[model samples]
Target: MEKEIKVSIACMTYNHESYIAETIESFLMQETDFNYEILIHDDASTDRTQEIIRQYEQKYPDIIKPIYQVENQFSQNIIVEYINHRRAKGKYIAFCEGDDYWTHPEKLQKQVEYMEAHPETSMCIHAAKRVEAKTKRKIADIRPFKESKVMTVEEVIEGGGDFFATNSMIYSREKLAIWPEFYFNGVVGDYPMVIFGALQGEFYYMDEDMSSYRVNSEGSWTQREFSTIAKKKKHYAEVARTLDEIDEYTDYRYSQAIQNAKKGHQFYLLLIQGKFKEIRQEEFLDLYNKMGIRYKLTSRMKHYFPGISRLLIGIKLNLIR
Candidate 1:
């Protein structure tokens, strides 16, 4: 006479009016026997997103609970609040955003069963089908590791280990509850959460592609253009700050700090080379010092020599552009 475990699906949305209905329909079609709830958090958007969500909430009153925000709180804040407040009753938590929809109806059932059977794992993640939203094309398939693997903090910090897409992760409530202050400030929040999960225990990886991850230019983070020198420098500074904060307490503290510092230095170089716009020499030099690049020759050598150090430092800049 034990109570059945419940799962809560945290579906966050912004202005995804075109895809919101499809996303909600997918969750409504889940073929799980156990009790499940879909908690939708909608940031204050000036689109028809609220209307669509209200429609679903009215139709599926028992299963769907919608939290429509009056003011705009970015994804980082919304996710933090959703995780803290909405996950009260569920023993397990899963995530899918408004743009992404679940492809497999049995995804919840399969993942919940796997986690229930395997107590050693803190979370279970599966493969996802990457779809380009504009063309509705299948760009690629993101697959997870073959078997259950224990990930170290260093591997996660260096971004070397296999990672599951945020939409595909199903984690235990007990594991998530430990980190109450888990809010991300940078462009990458999922990475830190995955690292935290890995540090807690082994992660189960299912090779099946059960979810779809839609990539489009309409979303909040993706829509902003960081092409200007000021914008790029500000972006890198925020990234460096977030990484520094993570490193301050984590085991791979020093290495992550060095990595962030190197990144800041490269961005500084780009700003100076007129690839972006001309920044103040003093300000640029101050950032270089903060990033631990004191010698002017060292900075010049990186630009002129074209070695591995230059390659590693300039990789992200090239990729973003």
Candidate 2:
């Protein structure tokens, strides 16, 4: 009889011909004594992505299971649908995209052990190093929280500091089953998942850096700018709807959700105008006030000034880059 797998790695791939192999190799190199299975869902790719997946499937039949789609799903709906339909046997369900690869072989082992030891903890996440694809240079390091504790809804509303990259999180099967459909529908899926996980049980933070997140110009949602005002408005409405759904919870977290929604509203306005200069002092002040942030008009003026705002935003972007 075969031993049961302890972890199910849900990997989604689109047109990642260049990086899929590295991603798969990282999973293969995991130095764990226990059994684990990798479930790969390939959204129909026009490139050589399918070929690479096929090669790996042949080489690692026992550990790798590939779900190849003939017609493009285009959206994450099919990917999430596949994960739900297939039914993972493992106690823990971990996620990683084909474009992102793990840097540490003990990544899964360490997370599994932590969750196993802490019954109250529903999820575990570690830090990730962001690297530029072309230069292969280390751009920024996203470090995890040093202390492990139950995250409060208030903290989440305040935009809980550093969240584990979606690829870095390992969640229990019991908690995953309760994940709402809204998570997959949002422009950002990871945030809702984090919120759901925290609601279920306490979160375990591993300060160590164990994953590499590659940022490139191609095949990224951030790269595509919403050119039309209608598109921008639609995006913002979706964000608002998502936040409103979470607003019913009467906790500090609800404040954080409102603040996040306010920020999203401000950003959408900026994008719709096609220039950040279009944002007036009054507009930002109104936004801050609506978000419940206490600030004077003078401070708002300083923040809206082109030169000052540019310098501050430039520094922040540089830090991320």
Candidate 3:
């Protein structure tokens, strides 16, 4: 009989023919003793992405199972993630998008070992390399947590809880089955998923930088999200809506943190759309009052003279560029 799969590698892709090879090779490169399977969900890419996936599926028929959609399911309001995730037949579910790849061959080995050793951890993530897709420039290395270890909810809350890298998380299948309705409908993917996992138990962290996260790639979500100012505004509002759902789901246990995060999103919306008049609104006061003295003063300055504040912010952003 075939060995039972211990982890299901959940991968989703669309129009990533150039990078999908690396992604599949990375999965095939993993040196894990325990059985794992790759579930590649392709949502009707017009490019050669699906063809490439088919090639790999044939090469590793035992380890690679693919879901090919002729009609793009995302456009049909089908929850691609939920449906694909339900297909997972493993104790752990790990995610890696088609455009991203694992760097270390031992990544799955290390992550699985840690998860097996610690039953209470709802999920775990590690550092990942953020690379600019066009220039292939090494932009920054990120490890949201300070060090490698189990993290408390308070720690996660205080840190804005946007810590988990999308592909880096490996979560227990048991705890993940407790997902709420908001996760299926109202939420905008990863943020709420991480927050939900945090609610169940502590999330482990690994300091190792073992994955590559492509930024601003063609046809990628990041590229589309920042392609225009309107999209940025929409993205921010979507984040707020997701957090609102989480707020209800958690019964306001992380209310303060949720509020702070929403304010940050709203602030970004103003920046992207030049809605400076919104500064005088009462919505920001709660965040303003709780902010540090310097931030409070900054908020006051921005509120009183939004034009000047906008000019100054523009200058600062341009300087950074």
How many residue pairs of model 2 clash at the backbone?
A: 4
1-321, model 3: which lDDT tens digit per residue?
878999999999988988899899998999989999999999899999999999999889999999999999877877777766899998999989888888999998999898888888888889988887755556788777567987766556445434556889889889888678777774357777777788887788899999988887766767655588777677667767777777787788878878777777676556444454575468765544555777656766776778999999889757766
Runs off by more than 4 Å, candidate 3: 154-162, 271-321
- Candidate 1, residues 200-292, lDDT tens digits: the string is 677667888888888763664444535556776676566566666666646555575348454545655474564333333553555545544
Off by over 4 Å in 1: 1-5, 75-87, 144-152, 160-163, 180-187, 225-233, 253-321
Arrange candidates by lDDT, descending.
Answer: 3, 2, 1
The segments of candidate 2 whose C-alpha lies over 4 angstroms from its true place after superposition are: 76-86, 144-150, 160-163, 224-236, 249-253, 264-321
Tens-digit per-residue lDDT, 238-267, candidate 2: 766666666654344465557765575665
Top model number, lDDT:
3
Model 3: worst 10 consecutive residues (lDDT sum): 154-163
In model 1, where is the ten-residue run with the lowest total lDDT? Answer: 274-283
Give lDDT: candidate 1, residue 102: 90
Q: What's the residue-level lDDT of 136 in candidate 2? A: 52
Clashes of each: 0, 4, 0
RMSD of each: 8.9, 5.7, 5.0
Best by TM-score: 3
RMSD of 1: 8.9
